[model samples]
Every structure is written in structure tokens, then in C-alpha cells.
Target: MPFTVYEHGAVAGWDVARPLRPGRSAGISLAGFRYRSAGSADLPVIPHPAVTVVVEFGDGSLVMGDASGWQQRGSLVAGLVPGAVRVRGENVTCVEVHVSPVVAHAVLGICPAELDRTVVALDDLWGRDAARLREQLGDAPSWEDRFTLTDALFSHRRGTGPPADPEVVRAWDRIIVSRGSVRVEDLAAEVGWSRRRLWSRFRSQVGLPPKRATTLVRFRHAAHRLTAGDSTARVAAECGYADQSHLHRETLAFTGVTPAALAADPGLAVDDIAWASTAPTETA
Candidate 1:
């Protein structure tokens, strides 16, 4: 079967559960064998930050590049950090993972310490030993299995620990639903905790203030629109920004690139790309 992007989670922060595509699904060329296919997309370049890992199976070769000097196509690439991504290729019978910081921590148990904004091969990690990873993707899977696979592939890095408080996660859900339009007090009240208590939980779990996470969610929402080629004004209005100017300023602040620039060339802005989808639970 062809690989498909699956959007998962109720929270506004995008999380995708994807499957390994069949060779025919994505046109892949490996060892002089040409496989013709087109891939899927999860999100667009956004003002919010994220990390992406591209994994290839068997002898499948991967090719990726953008307008900027950054480019790579390998058997495995892991360490691409938060950025705007313009990913397109054929024969990618592999998996693409995009992670929010909070979910990233929960799954990977750590963030990329050096902020690797380039593509590097991980063939050695899977070298001569892909069976473990293949088994992890086998039948009768559960949430724990998904979590475990994610942790195994990316959690060994440095700079983070286990998940934070459950209450903090609950608070994050509420904020995503509100799309950053709700008051902090409202979130605290919903969780039956004081504002300060809620903020503390958020900081501990997500490593950022509640307000910052909210901003990130809003930017993420706007980023989807931007990727779809929507105007900044449209994205801002749809995502509850104060105005187009508000969207522009906020995007520049978070991504260090203009919204226009991001939309025009997603491959360059490493921090604003959407790298995953919310599917796969159903396929399993």
C-alpha cells in the first residue's frame, strides 16, 4: 500500500501518524531501478517551529532539497530541526515525522541539542539492523508502541526528559481548541486550578510559558493556510490574529523570516515547515 499522511490529536498542534509507502506509491529510484510516484503533505511552512526526520527503508534512496544551500537525499536523515520545509519527491517508501516540542519531548524524550538545521544520514543507526524497527511497526500495535518507536528513533539524543504533568497536557489541549483566543484564567479555571498553578505546570511540561505555547499554536494554524497559498491577511483573520500586520510581525518574530518569504520558498526556512500528518491508527 502507498504511504498516507494521517492527522491525529485533538490539540491544535499538528501531529501526523504516517505509514510506509509502497514502492509504487512513491516513485523511487534505487540502484538503477526507477519507481515513479508522488508523495503526500501534512502541513505548510508556518511561523511556529518544528523538527522533521526522514527515514528510508531497504535500499530506498531519498532526495530532498530547497532553494537555499541546504539539501540532501539519503537512505536516512534525522536531525533536521525546526524550519520551513518544502518536501517533494518520488519513491519515498519510508516515513516522515513532524513533531511539536511538547509531543517531541514526550515521544523522543529529548530535543535536538545542537539545533541541526541540515540534513545528515543515519544509515549507521539502522545499518544492518532494520528488523527491530520493522517489528515495531507490526500488527496489534497500541499507543505505547507508537510512542516506543518514536522514542527509539529520536529520544536517545540529549537535552530533555520524560513527559511533564498530565494536567499540563490537559491545559495544552484547551489552549489548542481555543486557538489562542481564550484567557489564561479561563484555562486555569477549566482545569480547576489557579492561574499560577496552571502556568507552572505548562512551564514544567512544555518548557515554555502558556502564552508562548498559545502563540505557537496560533502560528501553526496560520502556517497551514500559508502553505496552502493563502494571503497573510486571510490567514491572520482566520487564525484569530489581530490583523494581517499582527500576523506578519508575529511570524517574523518567531521564524526570523517574512510570511511571504516562507510561502514563496518553504525549503529555506527550517523552523516553519509542517512535517507530519494525523493518519495511520486507522490503517493499522
Candidate 2:
């Protein structure tokens, strides 16, 4: 088989497509999704290191919330949301932004800690600003126009906040560069902070403690590998689990599904459509 730029996978619905263009910054990217039909149940949402903002337009609305039946309508801003949430709507058109935790505080104007692995209405965060955004996006002529408007707003808002701690940003970069395989102790040492200092700073600034961050980063890598069709043992070994059982437990804990089940998830099967970085949206 020929090797392609197959990095990982994401989501899409009927007539959905990738963003008009990729975000210029290393910390962000945008995807536009549309669905012609409505789902009866909430679709499962998986978490990664990046915080997400979903802006919806069109005929119907959807809720982004957890399994206990908690959900919120209007645009969603979430940080490291764990477990499954349902996304059900009809004739949906939306642009979803993936914000690196490293810069999320600046872009979103709140600590990821405040979000605490939960979904909230974007309006709650930006108040009237959120309403303005919804209006602008809905009125925009095209997906590209909406995306540009979004980027401009984000750029303007992001510049208003103080930059995230430099050391914290470096630590996050290291984790991604290492594919989540780096040691936290080593990271702390490199950042010239004691373990306790690193823990406090990272948890407050990035929303996850150093240890948990590593686990989530590692789990993210493992989840992608599973979705990419690697065997349990291979993914476990390559992603640094002690054994397949260790991988099993962690994957189950994160996704609420066995590795096999997660690999075959229809929700994620379409994820590549939403997140395939190099590909443009495919129309049908």
C-alpha cells in the first residue's frame, strides 16, 4: 500500500466538509460540518488535549452534553471533556475549532481549569460577544467567510489576554513532540521547575496535572493508533503501556469502550472527514 498523509481521524455528517483553509497558527484549526438528517440519540464525543469550540448555524440545533442527560444548546466551548456526549441535530452547519491547550487560555480568555472537562455554552464565556459571533457567522456568505470572521475575532480576542506561561507552553510542546512519551519529571527538570511547581502551574494553566496530562496525551496517541487500525498489542507496545491489559484498562477508562469497539465507531469513522489536515472537504 502507498503511504499517504494519514495522520488520524475525525467526524462529518451529510454534506459535511473540511474548513475552507487551515488556521495559520500552530495552535488552531477549523472544520466545517453539515448533516442533513437528525440523530435520535446523542452521538458520543471523545476528548483530546485540545479544547474545542463548535459554532452551529442552519435549520435545527443540537446539544453537546454528557450521558447523565446533561446538555446545553447554542454554540459549545469545552475543555478536555471526558466520556461520551450526544450530538443530535437536523440540517446542521457548523465550524468546529480545535484549540491547543497551550494557547486555549489566551484564545478563550479563561483557564481550562474553569471548564473542567465539561461543556458550556459559548455564549456564557463571551456573553454578548458570543451573540455577535453567531450573528456574523450565520449571515456570512460562505464557509470561508465565516472562517475568516472567526479567525479575526479569535485573533483580536487572543491579543487582549496575557500570553500563557512560557515554561508551560514549552512543556506542552515537548509532550506533543514526544508523542506523549516523555517523562514528567524530565519535563519539570527541563522547565527548571520542581515537581510541585510544575504540577501547580501545569494544572492551573493547561487544565490537567502533569501526570494526567501525560496520560491523556498518551491515550490520545493510542486512540488514534487504534482508529488507524493497529492491533491492541502493537498500539500498547508502541504507546508505552506495560502490556496489552494495561492498554485495555486505560483505553476503556477513557473511551467507555473496548479498543475493538472504539476502532469501529461510526462516529469516529467519519472523524477523518472533519480533521484530516491536508484534505479539502469532499462533497457528495
Error of 2 at 230 (Å): 1.6
Please report, in order, the local distance difference test score of every candidate based on alpha carbons: 0.51, 0.75
Assess candidate 1 and give its lDDT.
0.51
Please give the clash total of every predicted structure, in order. Answer: 29, 8
Q: After superposition, how far is residue 268 of candidate 1 from its true place, in Å?
A: 11
Q: Which 10 residues in a row give candidate 2 its minimum summed lDDT?
A: 1-10
Q: Write the per-residue lDDT of candidate 1 for residues 62-154, one digit (tens) a residue.
A: 565545656565544333233444444454334455544455454444433333444455444345334455344333134334434644555
TM-score, each model? 0.53, 0.88
List the candidate 2 regions with Cα displacement exceeding 4 Å. 1-12, 24-26, 38-42, 279-284
